[model samples]
Target: MSELKIVDTGNELRLLGMDEASKLLGIQKSTLYDMTMRRAIPVVKIGRLNRFKLSDLEAFINQNRQEAQS
Candidate 1:
């Protein structure tokens, strides 16, 4: 069997586990899990584990950004 390795390109595109993702979003891990279950968030499935892309999460935040009323 061939072993798979992850190569870092020095970009902001790193896979984050549930704990890191939740902390980055400042939300509960359960909430992040729920979001993934509901397909409201982008996720990467590795076996039975859930992984998220830092860039994707940043995009989610950007897409959800709201401006103050003038």
Candidate 2:
């Protein structure tokens, strides 16, 4: 029997760029930027760079889902 091993990239918890976050969320890049500018989504800024955490994105999605159902 062969066993499959999973490798952790460590990026799952790290910050993601706008494009990366958009891709992950399956949304348009422009929409993500607009949300960020409006403070409608969670994000972190490091100097001149904007970053989003995977955890924060997940939470945002969950919150949206709940809001839609309510």
TM-score top scorer: 1
Candidate 2 TM-score, C-alpha based: 0.73
Tens-place lDDT per residue, model 2, 1-70, is 2222323379666888988899978899999999999999988999988899877887787666532343
Model 2, CA-based lDDT: 0.80
> Clashing pairs in model 2?
none
Model 1's lDDT to the true fold?
A: 0.84
lDDT of 1 at 2: 31
Instruction: Summarize candidate 1's per-residue lDDT along 1-70 as a digit string, tens digits.
Output: 2322334476666789999899988999999999999999999999999999977787787767676788
Taking all chains together, each candidate's TM-score versus the true structure is 0.80, 0.73
RMSD versus native structure for model 1: 10.1
Off by over 4 Å in 1: 1-13
Off by over 4 Å in 2: 1-13, 66-70
Q: For every model in order, what is the number of clashing pairs?
A: 0, 0
